[model samples]
Target: MTRPDVTLENYDDVYRFYLDHQQNRLLARAAYAALSARFRPRVRYADGARDRLRELLSSDTRLIVVANHLSDRDQYTLAATAWRTPLRRAVGRTRVLAKDELFVDPGLRRKIDMMGSIPVFRSKNHGLRAVADAGRRMMDVSAQRLHRGDVLAIFPEGTCNEGDPTRVQRINTGVGHIAVKARKLGTAPALLAIGISYGPDRSADVHVAAPVLELPGTPMDVTRLVTAELQGAVDHAVAAR
Candidate 1:
């Protein structure tokens, strides 16, 4: 049977299918490494970030990596960074959140799906009820992934920043919502912040902010903490350029 067309209103079903039929890990890793290397990102680890990551890995803690989106290739950059660092051990279980529109293109969707991408429909693109429903499912799926011990790398800003490279755009509350959900679930994932800067030549400087060691009670609390951390990482990375 031919699959039904997926729209913003019903993309959740499509996402569920992909989640169940996850991509091949070996293929995903190999492709990620090749793409990231071609993009040629220089990853800079903040003081103790590496050690902290290793510690988290040693204890088998799942990670929720948040970052400022710079370009369409940000996913590849972060994938390459993880593949090159101690986080390499966790690549097999890592999943990146990709906007739903990317999944609508046949050729691109194939590639995106193979990269262990989870589909996300942004509320900003739709009416209130549909967006609200999709947004809730997105957060629930994110929290579920964390509960399953998968590494989830997300762009909390939900899109690339076109205005100012050094300044982070207004973040959506999804990250905070995910954190709050985790709080209630009693299994909060380790929150990691990242900042990436692209030069005129397309070379990237990626910075890893120190992970938030603790989560606050409210969604706004989590939002403030992650926002401040990401902003700092962005500024530090841009200043280094």
Candidate 2:
């Protein structure tokens, strides 16, 4: 059976509903804090990781953090590790471009939404209009956030490449679209490519590479460069294995 078509309206409605649920928000934050603390010790950063990240995140500049996806647990690890540095200030305030399927579960949905995740539909069979609408929604808000100097994080791979060790998948160009729109609005956010790789036994030792690109540039150029850098980081991490 084919999945139902998802539109930008669906995303807005669900996100607003989740946000209105205060109890869920409170519980989710508590859960996130607990999980982060539990796995804190196992998390490790490369030399100069903290300083480099701080320098990148310290700016009032708008940002889009594009990282490689690995597993469901990877999001939490990324969030937790990021929280350890100045990046935590962007939490709850920043937007995360995520998959639409995550909204299916009330609990998980609430948690992620509370964390400022914006769902992006990834249906291969879906019409172009639907995809465009979703992109428009993201652009509208993302541009505003950029104008306001807020950060936004996105996983350019769209989904986890769990078993693939040799290659990174082709990235959707929507990130480029968002950047272009934001720039046109006179608020182009800096695109930061981040590579996240799991450690031995997935024990929470996440290797976070520094920002690959920081200067403002054209959307397509930024997208291509960021993807290349992120892929290179993943390759290096894998090679060390």
Candidate 3:
């Protein structure tokens, strides 16, 4: 059944699930298992990505994993890919940043929360105080999570490109802001870019580019660096198509 009152205005149990940090590891494993069993995506890494991924996984620094969004099933495929790749060990601790609207779907919401997704409320809807404040709170907590060593996997483009799935859209500045804030507070994490290309045969191609380690200058500078790298990744991933 669909949940109608799951909005931030009436946050109830649905929205609460999004705010909760205690993720069920068993459920997460189960979700990944089910995803793999059902839809087997052929995940492939780019040159030197395998070795780099292993090194990144072994490190204690948090990872800000950014990827291109294509469909609703992107998250599932991401989790499954991580489980099969060198990131398998770190999947359980990663928090997937998802839109708050996804929580409105009772069925999907449960699976999203179980798989360790963090709800994000965008403030572009209306400029109301509450909405703006929620956005600020999201950024603050997200920064804190990174400082605490929790990996965040977010879609910088914000939404899926329905008009042209092959191309990556413009990135929002939120990700860069979070990274800069984290750097200022001391603990600096790696900005890793991931690209996904889905085939007609239900198989998916996954590529992980090298990580961005240097965080210099202002937030805009860091944001542009990450944005350009991610765009390059998306273009490279879909170049064959």
Candidate 4:
């Protein structure tokens, strides 16, 4: 049943209430599992990558998974892969920073909202104010969730690069800001660099590198390290393609 105040204007507040009320992390896990099962895309991983991610989760680490965005399906593919891990199950909720357009359509919007995505506004007219407002909101929500020990996933590239099939472009600085803010609040989680690859058939393959760099440091340093690691991972993935 939908809540009384569950309108688009109050979407975030209502959604947060639902997530807190349900308190059922398994619902998210099950949803992702179903998505994966139906898709049934073959998954390949670097040796011990899953294990290493699980280990990181075992620690009090709040992760900001930086991946090179390729397609709309990329997010779901990553969610499916993460769901396969007991680590994600243990971590509770995995929140994704998604574009505001995803919420334009009622059905897709509902699904994204249920999946714990924070809608961000990106303007083509170079509206800096809208972008900044969205960024601030995203950071605030991410910081709050990180405080609760939830893993936050973001595509630092800002948008999917369909033109560049070879490598990831330079990353946006928003990711670094979120990391630094989380640290200033007290518990600064490790920033994890996640590289996602898609085969020609659209099957998903993932490689998670070590924390490219630690947080509670300067935002520029974190952004630089994340960009380098993500670029390298995308290069590797493209080579395999």
Candidate 5:
């Protein structure tokens, strides 16, 4: 299937295309296998972090995993690190919320699509007024995916933290909105915040927190909860590094 153009005009179709698409499991595993040998060795987790994540994955509870973005390579690092832990269980089923521009390159887009990435139209790129409706559609599809039992991985910071990698940037309310929408659709999703930090040896330190099951009343309130959890996760990752 030809991918729809990642433009405002094709936004709806682009998202819908991925929503119904089933990834080739064999291909997904192959890709992970190739990267794991390199990344698995370089990535370390906080003590008990792996066990915490493993327990969550063992349950029927749906997860919304949010992480702080430190670099463009964060996704790759996360992917590789996950392959060594329980996170690899959600490999083919996870829908990653990625920025719109990542889909522009045809070559990379195929891999992105196969990895179950959903394009996110950001207001910074298209202007607030322009991406308003399209953003809603993105969130709706995300919520629907969650309701369908797919794990969602998002960099709630939205962009890499170029200034202070130690601190988690302000998280957007989009995450909260998606979780709220999923809840409305009868899916009680749990939040899992992961923190990533690079060490002097270039190894990655990843800290995964136990899932936060209780959410606050409004979207903003949920966002605040996520903010606090993510910051604590980041601090753990840094200290571990």
Candidate 6:
């Protein structure tokens, strides 16, 4: 089925498009294959991480995957690692929250669509007041997706941490908001933090932390927890690299 053509001008239209979006298995498989071939990353899940994730994938518990921002290539490496690990189970079932600008180009949009990306109108790109309503809509769509059994992935840092690759930058509360919304929608999402580091050997090292089942209620509290977990995961990835 051909995906709907969404200009992303109307927030409601964009929300509807995602709510009704169909997963194209062939395209998703091809993209994952290409990512695996392009960047063959070595993945190392923290002790019991794989088992914990397996349980989550097998259960009805939805996961709000949060990761640190390292480089633009982080997404590619992360995808490649997932393809090589148990995360491949969620290959076609995950919805990634991506910046809206990435959907502007037709060619890139097609690839991103195949990857199940949900366009996010970030306040950094648009003024806080301008994107406020749209941001809420996007978060609602995201929560609905989770409630409907789609795994949600987000980069809490919002942008690449160019200052220090080893240290995780301050996380934006957007991820917290998404989690809180998901909880309100009765999803009660679990947190899964993945850390990525490129080693001196030019090999990508990924550290998947154990899932956090207990989540705080407020957005600020959730953001603080995510920041701490992500930083720990990143520290492990850097040390193991």
Candidate 5 clash pair list? none
TM-score of 1: 0.92
Tens-digit lDDT track of model 1 for 1-241: 2333457767677656644555788988788788766876778888999899989988878788888888887887888778777778776677788888887888888787787787787766776677787778778877777777778888999878889888989888888888788667768677888888888888878888787768888888888888899998887778768
- What TM-scores do the predictions have? 0.92, 0.78, 0.86, 0.83, 0.93, 0.93
The predicted structure with the larger lDDT, 2 or 3, is 3
Tens-place lDDT digits, model 3, residues 1-241:
2333546665344344434465677777777877877766666556787787788778876788898888887887788777777767775677888888877777877777677777776655444565665565666677777787778888888877787766778788888888877777787888888887887875677767877777655767777877777777766767644
1-241 in candidate 4: lDDT tens per residue? 5542433455466445533432346667677888767655344445666666677777767777878898888887777766665445642377787876676678876677667777665554336764565456667667777777777888888878878656887688787778888888886677666677777688766666656435548778888878887877666566555
How much RMSD separates candidate 3 from the native structure?
3.6
Instruction: Give the range where candidate 6 is weakest over 10 consecutive residues by summed lDDT.
Output: 1-10
Give Cα distance to truth, residue 160, candidate 2, Å. Answer: 1.9
Each candidate's lDDT (Cα)? 0.79, 0.64, 0.73, 0.68, 0.84, 0.84
Lowest-scoring 10 consecutive residues by lDDT in candidate 1? 1-10
Which digits, one per residue and each the tens of the lDDT, describe model 6 over residues 9-87?
Answer: 5777787888758569677877887899989876778889899889888886899988887777877887786788777
In model 2, the runs with Cα more than 4 Å from the true position are: 1-32, 41-49, 125-129, 212-216, 239-241
Off by over 4 Å in 1: 1-5
**Model 5: per-residue Cα lDDT over 1-241, one tens digit each:** 6668998878878877877777787787777767777765344555676777778778867889998998887888777766777888888888899998989999998898777889998887888999999989999999999888789999998888989889888889999999999999999888888888887776788877767878886899999999999998888888875
- Write model 2 residue lDDT over 135-204, tens digit each, in one string: 5666666666667666778878776785774467777777777777777878756555555556666754
Better of 1 and 4 by TM-score: 1
Kindly give the number of clashing pairs for every candidate: 0, 0, 0, 0, 0, 0
Task: Please give the distance, in angstroms, between residue 138's alpha carbon in candidate 5 and its true position after superposition.
Answer: 0.5
Cα lDDT for residue 105, model 2? 77
Error of 2 at 87 (Å): 0.8
Task: List the pairs of residues colliding in candidate 1.
Answer: none
